[model samples]
Target: MNILIAGATGKTGARLTRQLDEAGHHPVAMVRESSDTSVLPHGVETRQADLTDLADDVCEGADVVVFAAGSGGDTSEEMTDKVDRDGAKALIDRAKAKGVSRFVMLSSIGAGDPDPESDLAHYLEAKHAADEHLKASGLDYVIVRPVALTEEDGQRDMTIGDGVDPEGKAHRGDVAAVLARAVDDDLLLNRVVELESR
Candidate 1:
């Protein structure tokens, strides 16, 4: 599959790109012109694109698009809305325009109903908006909402459901594995799955 990984320089995105390459799939790292992609695996294909202003041809020829971008911890709420919500929405639009058939969104566990009192409420709200956009975009989509992320290695064993334990956590590597699987798994089509470590 020709998979376009937005935010390919991010922690989980980098892992997913590497894993897809190792698994004999074409993983195209979609990055911004200013992004430092030196940490990415050598010889990996890369395309320059700013998700905030996605071009119509950005997703041309891509079979699947995976959005792993975030605004980062230092950014403001507005930035989060732009990158997390608007950026994702832009990519979805491009995907549809360019004939990309599948999209996998990495969302947060509480995106469906963000708690107003939570510290992450703003972020969750942005994610929720993006998830809703994808659901209505008329494209085959998989929304993976993982709980707290850890740096542990990929275990592959995970519990996937709509209402998993709130206290559960997921390894970044394991989450990447699931995203890779969603690329070709017909069973994951149009599903919003919450992921947690078993």
Candidate 2:
């Protein structure tokens, strides 16, 4: 499988890129011109593309498209909308046009139903819109909604579904495992699963 991963240089995205490669899939790390590709797995293919302004060929030749990009917590709400909302929608559109098999979205837990009173309301709102866009894009999609992310190593002992702890922390590596599995796992096809480190 030729998996094109957006934000492949980020914490969780890096893990996903390596895992997919180790699993014998071709993982293409989609990055910006300034992104540091040194963090990616050795010999992993890379495609230069900016999320805020993606070209029509950004998703070309990809079997699957994984969107893991974000504007970061320190960025403003406008930036959040640019990268998380509009950017994801644009990527989804490209993937559909390119005939990608599946679209995997890395979304936060609260994105399913954002609360305006929450401190992360802006970020969640952006993710909510993006997730919705993907769902309505008429593509085979998997939305992995993970709770607060932690830097811990992947335990691989995950509790997935509504039974997962809403307030619990998810190891970044474990989340990567789920995203990688969604690439070819029919069980996760077109399903939105919540993830928690158990």
Candidate 3:
């Protein structure tokens, strides 16, 4: 399958890239020029472009678009919107324009919450807005809102289900494996699922 991985340089996205590479899928890594591209191993297609401008042809002929991009850590709502909301929106718009079949978003657990008053609320708000937008865009999309992230070393052996507390925490590698599997599964289609490690 042809896949476009946005923010492929991030932790989860990086692991997904490796998995996709091993699975023999055509993985296209969409990265910003200034962002580090060292994480994603060799043999994947690398396209340097900013999400704000969201250059086209990135996802053309692609079957899936995995939006795993984000602007790290506490910041203004403006920055949050730019990288999380507008960034995801730009990829979605381009995916639709290019006729991509599916879009998967690596979101956060607080996405369904309406209040944005915590230290991380702004980030959650940005992700939630993007999730809402994707759901309303008339496309096949899955939004997985994982719990608080942990930098714990590789845990691809984990599992996820529907009833876990949205307040739990998860390993970054586990989230990466989830994205890796999302390309070929229908477990969360057209739904906003909150995830926790098991």
Candidate 4:
């Protein structure tokens, strides 16, 4: 499978790209011209496109799309809305137009229901809109809502679905593993799952 990974240079996306490559799948790193490609695996395929300004051909040749992109914590709420909400929706639409097989979204835990009082409210709201968009996109989809993220190594032992503890933290590596598996894993197809380190 040829998987196009948005945010492929970021921590989790980078890990996911390598994992897919190691698993003998072709991983296409979707990046901006300014992005640092050094973190990507050697000889990995790349497609240059900015999340904020995507083209119709962005999803061309992709069998699946993993939206692992985000406007960083330091970015303004407007930027978050642009990248997280609008950018995601745009990509989803493009993928649908290009006939991509599946979409795997990396959403945060509280995205299903945002708390207005929380500091991450805006971020969660943006994600919530995107998640809803994906659900209604009429495409095969998998939404992975992981709790707080950590930089720890992947345990690969995860508590998924109803067994997930909301307060627990998930390792980025483990999240990456889950995202890569969602590409074609029949069990995860069209399902929304919460993830936590076991």
lDDT of 2: 0.94
Could you give candidate 4's per-residue lDDT for residues 1-198 as a string of tens digits? 999999999989999999999999999999999999999999998999999999999999999999999899999999999999999999999999999999999999999999999899999999999999999999999999999999986689999899788889999999999999999999999999999987
Point out the higher-scoring one by lDDT: 2 or 4. 4
TM-score for every candidate vs. truth? 0.96, 0.99, 0.92, 0.99
Model 3 is weakest, by summed lDDT over 10 consecutive residues, at: 153-162
lDDT of 3 by residue, 114-157 (tens): 56577777787888889888988888988877888888645565
Q: Clashing residue pairs in candidate 4, if any?
A: none
Tell me the alpha-carbon RMSD of every candidate.
1.1, 0.6, 1.7, 0.6
User: Could you tell me the TM-score of candidate 2?
Assistant: 0.99
Candidates in order have lDDT scores of: 0.91, 0.94, 0.81, 0.96
lDDT score of residue 100 within candidate 2: 93
Q: Which tens-of-lDDT digit does each residue in 47-128 have in candidate 2?
A: 9999998999998999999998889989988999999999999999999999998999999999999999999999999999
- The candidate that wins on lDDT is 4
Candidate 4 least-lDDT 10 residues: 151-160
| Residue 128 lDDT in candidate 3 | 81
